[model samples]
Target: MQQDERQRKMKIMEVRMREIELSLSNVKLLLREKVAQLKEQLHKNGKADVLIGNLYDENDVLLEVLEKTKQRHIILEKKNFLLEEKISSLNKIMCDLTPPPSLPYHY
Candidate 1:
């Protein structure tokens, strides 16, 4: 009878061991799936980061171009003012060099 009881206990232990092994296998599979998902997410995030960086670089270049354009506009405005002054001076000189016509009247 003791031998029979021992045999029954051993059987129960074997069954429990099998259940634990199945549970461990399931946990391992879930872990592997989660790791794979995380890796994929990391890859996508890396690509997004690179894209954002490139956009920032492009924005910086555009800002530089805009600054240069503004400076050029200012320079042109100054040049235009100088040219206008020179043209006015030349017109005055030309008017002064011309002779006035004389009118004759009999009283």
Candidate 2:
């Protein structure tokens, strides 16, 4: 029973390893095909290839800037909330400190 169980586990592992290898081979083949296609396009449209590269770089830079802007916006929102709370507290204090006006003398 022990030997049989061990054999079964080994067989399962072997099958899993084969599946992983097949997947890796498929991925490599797809990468090769995509590279060939891109090379062919570059050869056919030289100016377009350069434009694509420039556009990709610009897109990367814009995405980075957008991320930074979003982070700054979050920080600013927090600061605004804190300032609003502080202003409200100060207003309450000022109201408490100020005295009401006395009535004028009667005729």
Provide C-alpha RMSD values for all models, in order. 4.2, 19.7
Report the lDDT tens digits of candidate 2 across residue range 22-100. 9999999999999999999878799888899999999999999999999999999999999999999999999999887
The list of candidate 2 runs beyond 4 A from truth reads: 1-44
The per-candidate count of clashes, in order, stands at 0, 0
Q: Which residue pairs show collisions in model 2?
A: none
TM-score of each: 0.63, 0.56
Q: Model 1, range 18-76, lDDT digits (tens) per residue?
A: 99999999999999999999999999999999999999999999999999999999999
Task: Judging by TM-score against the true structure, name the best candidate.
Answer: 1
Clashing pairs in 1: none
